[model samples]
Target: MKIRCRSAVFAAMMLLLVLAPGVSRAGYDYVDISNPFLRKIPIAVPQFKSFSGTPEEMKRARSSSQLLAETLAFTGYFKILDPASFLFDPQKDGIVAPRINFKNWTTVGAELLITGGLVQTAGLVEMELRLYDTFKEKLLLGKRYKGALADQRRIIRRFCSEVIYKLTGHRGIFGSKIAFVSTTSGNKEIYTCDFDGYRPHKFTNNRSINLTPMWSSDGKWIAYTSYAKGNPDLYIKNVREKRGTVVARKGINISPCWVPGRFELSATLSFTGDQEIYLLTGRGKIIKKLTNNRGIDVSASWSPDGKKMAFVSKRSGTPQIYIKDIVTGRVRRLTYEGKHNTQPNWSPKGDRIAYTAIADGEINIRVIGVDGNGLIQLTEGQGDNESPSWSPDGSLIVFSTNREGPSRLYVMTSYGTDQRRLLEMPGEQSEPNWSPNIEGP
Candidate 1:
């Protein structure tokens, strides 16, 4: 695909020299620590134990172990062991003292084991967990994570994340959610789903066009571009409170992203003389001017640190990705590998940036380092793969592709494995953005 850049080649070169130092490296913050090529290890989880409370009072005690197993297994790691087939009773000490039979677990090709116990004291719940290395016959990580009975699931998610971190030294995204634009009915709407593409429940029932949804760092609200009243407008949706509000109702205000520190949001508003990026406080106060280019400069995504920004610019004649320094207000193009690259989505870890590339008239999702190196193409030969969204852990990308049939949600590994389609089918979905599952947004 051929990309048309309005900025002259000479002009782009000159801009690079003067603006290179000014471009803030503050925009993308998701760190790339996971190795996609490594094979996942086998693991075992004996249902977590309980000491004081009844099985029912333990809340997630009975299912917490299974949930952890499934969560780790779905991540392409830890082939879990089935307790029914094991020699030991998984729930033996589940309601009391828990002990693991290492030999029994090793007999079934298990390398790692995870055990825990739930204890309720004076109407409060507390939990203890232990991870063991079967071969070494020693405890790998044994620590007690205590939380209220109401927070057992929360404790489980955190413990599971800790296990992943101890094993790979990289944070896990098992508890994250993906935010995307789904058109289930005749009208386009915004929806939220798990990172694995499961439990895709709709959040917006408005009969309007909403696109480019972004989550705040706090994960309390979601900012999206909607055209309910008429022209494209920006709206914020809170997950827990189940509240939605219009941030920008007039002009072509789109690509709303929250700046770090929760000070304000950075968005593009055409209400100005032309389309340019601006920073607005949480209360909708314009704080600063981000871009001054006469060309189409929009889609500003903040780096994890909130210092620099990565946005799509036509200043180079064709649409290409560029990184700008916030301190001095200079810019440099990050993508020169493909033409017509747009929709630069920054990962939470601040490691990789996913975008759409036009090749032979086909749009395929691709990823590259923020420095414009280590370019890797994830989708090839699909109908048209666009809107590459990163899982909060930077493990996979949920994108929409018109493959085999119509435009449906397709989830792929960050390194492009298990290219599976989500949903049974029958509608058009596009522009997926994954959110950290801390709160709502």
Candidate 2:
């Protein structure tokens, strides 16, 4: 298969060298930190300085600064300092290292600070960002980024990823994207947005019903089910190229799940009169059938090691989650508490599987251990919560809820704390799939 290159509106020029001036303590390792006991870091982010001598430059600088602050706060690790309480005005203060007042920030209860300067020249914008450890009074990380004036969000997110990497050993998911199904345009279509729900744009304009947007293991392609040709057919679309190829089959092709670290996928097909799961290549060539049950079987989620799969089956006369071993073909029932349980998402860390279960006449999110022990319920009284998808790092889960009004996407930690809505849009959003962190240049 030929890979298609997707071009953005702006080009990024990232500097290779990063300057860290003084000795800094080893930051918190999130991999070792448990979700329930982790504490948020206190940090301050002031408005970026403007040097372009134009009103538009000043406005852009302020927006970029706020964007950076929000991105950092969204990580669930940082407590952003309010700008109204700052002792020194970031707009009036100098942004260079020599002119920074560490005491001013430290007195305001900021353990860390981020300051940057933005300048727009011709059609391009140049940004210089520096992260500071106020207690130590030393520069922790600094970078120079250049891009189009319209691409300020991307530039800021790039720097934020660097800051996360310097503080935590792993890079942040700032560059990762979310694929979802939305009904904003009077029809169900696949749409995508940034990790923070910005830059939302439609991926498929087929003007037909689309469902279950799943990203490939490599994040290059998105597989979804579309009813454009009168039947539910599976389609693989190159996200950058904005084109799709249908996986032609006899019957319904729905609920496609990619095998970890491979070019093949497992999906539910109704070619044999009843829905069953089958394994296929990236090009939709049938490799083998995984489920041979007479009842309806769908929604396949691959384990991290590719040794097992968790899926929804009705073989017991009710929808429930079941795990199947790929080699031995041994099927084990995982959920017996909920009357209707479905949409099992295997965690990327290989510890737990998150799914949606109906209990007390409401649909809620639940998680169970891989060994069928330690079952925990995440959501209780919010609304009808369904379609729980785990983040690439397995630290957070993004699901949809209709509690407030229309259905909107929400993100919560893996332990079911900090439940916050992700985006507020016009249409109903569902089936959120987080992409793997795509490395930026």
Whole-model Cα lDDT of every candidate shown, in order: 0.71, 0.84
Give the root-mean-square deviation of each candidate in angstroms: 13.7, 4.1
Question: Candidate 2: deviation at residue 126, Å?
Answer: 2.1
lDDT of candidate 2 over 1-441, digit per residue (tens): 222222344333433345554435445452345652266777989888888657888888889889899988887778898988887665678776678888888888898899988888766777889988888777778887766665677788888887877776567677678899899999999999877788788888889899999998789889999999989999988778867578868889999999989988999998878888999998888899999999889999999889999999999999999999998999999999878999999998898999999889899999999899989999988889999988776767899999987889999888887789888777999999988776561
| Candidate 1 accuracy as TM-score | 0.76
Candidate 1: where is the Cα deviation over 4 Å? 1-37, 46-65, 81-99, 115-129, 141-155, 169-171, 194-200, 241-250, 421-428, 437-441
Scored by TM-score, the top model is 2
RMSD of 2: 4.1
